[model samples]
Target chain A: MDDPLMLARVQFALTAGTHFLFVALTLGLATLVALTQTRATLSGSAVAERMTRFWGQLYVINYAVGIVTGLVMEFQFGLNWSGMSRVVGEVIGAPLAMETVVAFFVESTFLGLWIFGWDRLNRWVHLGLIWVVAATAYFSAYFILVANGFLQRPVGFTMVDGQARLTDLGALLTNPTALLAFGHVVFGGLLTAGFFMAAVSGYHLFRRTAEADLFRRSMRTGLVAVVVSVMPVAAFGGMQYAYIQPTKHPGAQESAAQVAQFEARFGPGDYTPPGLATAGEVLMEVAWSLMFFLAFAMLVKLPFGRWLERGRVFHVLMMAALPLPYVAMISGWVFREVGRQPWMVYGVLKTEDALSDVGAGAVAVSFTVFTVLFAALVVVNVWLLARFARRGPEAVRLGAPGAPEPERPALTPTF
Target chain B: MQTLALVVLAVLTAGYLVLAGADIGMGMLLPVLGRDGRERRLVIAAFAPFFLANEVWLVAVAGVVAGAFPGLEHALLSGLFPVFVALVAGWVVRDAGLWLRGRVDAAAWRAVCDGAIVAGSWALALSWGAVLGTVLVGGSRVEDGVNAGTVLGLPLALVFAAHGAGFARWRLASGLAERARRVPGRYWVSGAALAALPVAAGARLPWSQVVSSPEALAVTAVMCVLMVPLLAAAQALVWWTFRGRAESPGYL
Candidate 1:
């Protein structure tokens, strides 16, 4: 508990985990929102447009915290893990930098345009902005995974004067670990979005809200999203376990030689990850199995959309199932990150060696601050999402034509 | 490549200061610019559409630093760990406040979020000033010793506040703009403050000693070359789209 390394690790886990919670939804919903908007533009359906605004508002709210949490994640690397930067930063830095340039920069700008450009710009242009935002969002995820992939299975870099230098850009970008993980993450995002939409729409249907038609259509969309994405999510997770895990972790088939090579190069240490890695993997698998069964059940209802909408039991089940994808995604993330234990950059840099020269006290303070803040954010984010979800599309103000002004006081206060 | 990286870093930093600085400043004066909850919402709406785009400039700066000058990222961020922590905390709080303020239609919720915005904005402005001051006075290493540059943090924060006021005067409706006018200084001061931050910070760092390997730098620079123009174009679109004065409260 007193060790700075342990504290730093916990802090990273909590903060990064919280950030991923928002990001999973952001990536998925951004795509959904873009698709909905595209349909609205092409068909000129007011229902689709309202759907876009409704979902888009939630996306923005989630994204707001995601961006800030991401900033903290970036800062954590330099603040608590400077040693990794001092060593292998050159290799991973390129993809990370490209991410900011290509994704963060473009995504934010386009989203801003998309948000404020409604009714002001040409309809086609406004629609184009969302697609751009969605594309850039994926690009952002890809670049980040590339960097994380480097840590999982370092390649295309050579050690020189105690620092890893980039030798092959192509090899670094196409690291199979990154590509596979990318698929898993993207599918996981879609699954999360599917459940979120279904849960929200299900709640409305259970209560027989005035917008039954709207909720029904969204319910269908949500179910379709789940049916399409869940299989891929499971498949990708299986692929990673089958293909990537054995190569990275010791005690797995064909991993003895790599373990031996590591021991010889870095001198004797525990080398193997702790038991928690297996625990996380098991938890993830269990969650996935549960989601798979639930998804299948939902698939059965898809053909009978009318019965499904009125089924209070199904709505309750959906609301209950809302947390499944979140749980699975986090557990899967835990497995991936924790499974690579002892090494911050597997085989290249030990976790202990990558810590910054900060005191235990400072790390503790930061750990406490970040945890509390993130927890508060998560609470508030969920509360807001739930509140808005309950209110339904009637409350959506995003891109509303001539939004009413806030009530001004009789006398404005002087500056 | 090194020069290009440095140039990109400079441009991004300056862009953040000039663009995002206005919103941060506006956040600092959120209460003053708008009296009641309704007024405050308006003040926030004035900058809402542009804030996300503006903040990304800082993200870009951090990216450039980490990617092209890992040594600098390691040295600067860790050397001034406490300051960075405060800055990040402020950033998180401020953003959370802005994003969540209007989501719920409760007076208390908005009030609390507003308080977070003001406090977080001030914290961001002051901590950024501290970072700059620490570098200026302490050179490459940020020591605990108080110096002239350290003392300068407060005044720099005020500069940010004034920059926000100037921005408010320009973007707000006529009634709110008049209220903002009392603070004095308009776009010129804002521009000067924006241009000054990067130059001051740039002068303090030993750029030659902090650059990464040539290959990494070259790759990063090429990326910047490809993306910066697109960033510029998209940013111009945002500014153009919202060119008119903020008339109604935007989605927060």
Candidate 2:
């Protein structure tokens, strides 16, 4: 752990893992809230309006933390892995710079308008702001994956005077690895958000809270979202397995050829991923399969989720399942990142070569500081989320300009 | 084109420093100016919206640096790795604290968040100043390598603190405003006096060979000199435009 290389890897794993938790939620919830508000605008239903505010409130909570965590993620490139930055700064940094100049500004600016412009803007304009936020969020994710894709499988770049330079911008954006990875991540994000809403609403309805009608409706929406999203999520994961797996573990004959080639080019580095990463990949697949089955069961067996509406065991199950998708997502990320070890930019810059000329003590100290700070942040994030979630939607301040006053309670205590 | 890019980058950096300084000042002033939690909230709310917008300049500056001068950025960031990490951490913690403060109702939790804000703000101010000191003293010349603390560190921090206090003085009102006004008077004078160290240090370098274009350097220097009065005018205009007593709106 004291070794700078190991410490740096640990730091990246901790920061990226923690950062992904927030990102997954932000990506998924942003889409869901947009859907709720869009539906509310079209049908003008009171329940839909309440749904928007309630979930939107939670979305804001998650998004605020996500933005900060992301800032830290961006800095680590320069601070921890200066070698990677210097080698690929011309190529990878292009997308990141674009992410800031184009995607971030759009999402952040519109999000502000959508948040504070509640009473100021026209309703349609307000709705548009959210869609912009959602679009830009996904767009930002795309450019980021484009950069990451290059790392997974280097493309459209040439070594010029000891630096990787962009030779074809089009190929970089159109890289198959990045597109597949983007699909897997985006759909996975939706799945995470869907299950989260279902589980939270399930908890409320199970307790027979005063907002049963609202919770029941919310649970149904979540269930639908889960059912819809699981297909694309599975499809994309399958696509990745087919595309990325063989490259990692080539057939015995090809493996020999590849190893010899790699050794000739860049001597004495392990090209193979650790055995545990394969196990994690398997765990991710197994967990995703289970999620699919659960979604199907909820949709068909429950029939409008009426069965799940009242059963104590079912609510407990839903609540229990909340952390599973998160687990799967994290395992999948770990597998992906760790799979490409030894090379920070796969075949170009070795991880050892990419490190800054800093002392081991410096890396260790920074790692400790970041870990403690991140842990504290996660605690605050989870506490606020749980507290607000249990409080129900009435606790949501619903009186923004165009927002309607509270309707008479629709929830009847059926239990 | 390279010179032009460098000049643009310099302006962007200056923009971030001035804008973000005031924002950090708001957080730093929380413990100092706020008599209680309510007053603290008022101080935070006074600049929270603007803080988010001001922070964008940070992202933009970084983006421009990476895009425009990849080599320089590489050397600077790697050479100053420890400080960069600390600065990044400071930014993360500060953002979390400020945003999270308004979300909860618990007194203990609020206090924790406030502590995060104070610590983060101070770290950012100090680290940023230290970076300036490093650059001003010449990147490779400092004796302690990457870990060496620069002479400009304290002065830069003080100058930024003064900038923040000035913003708060103009933007906030009553007790908070009065306290904020005193911060610059306390720190800015000394900071200004100490600012000569970096200039004198930089004079030791072969100044003519610093960049390829002497005109660009001359223009930048003139711009740098012009910034002080320009910043003063800009702040004065903003204060007058939003002037009067500082009152926290119920919504913000």
For each candidate, the alpha-carbon lDDT, in order, equals 0.85, 0.71
User: Tens-digit lDDT track for model 2 on B180-200?
Assistant: 766754334433433443444
Q: Write the per-residue lDDT of candidate 2 for residues A1-415, one digit (tens) a residue.
A: 7799888888888888887888898999999999989999999999888989999988988887788777877777777777776677767766676676566755775676576556556789889879989998998899889889888888887887687777777788888888998998898898899889989998898889898877887888787878888989878877876546333553446556766778898776677666667667888888888898888777774465566578777687788889878988998887787777656777788788887667798888888988898788788789989988999887774324212212222212122
Write one digit per residue (lDDT tens) for candidate 1, span A1-415: 9999999999999889988999999999988888899999999998998898889888887887788789899989989999988999878889989999889889988888887677789999989989989999999999999999999889999999999999999999999888888998898999999999999999999999998878888888888888899889888777765546453455775667766777798887677777777777788888888888988988899999688768899999988899889988888887888888888988778899999987888888889888899889988888888888899898887888445544553435454
DockQ per model, Cα = 0.66, 0.22
Q: What is the lDDT, from 0 to 100, of the residue B223 in candidate 1?
A: 88
Residue A33, candidate 1: Cα error in Å is 1.3
Model 1: CA > 4 A from native? A242-258, A401-415, B142-148
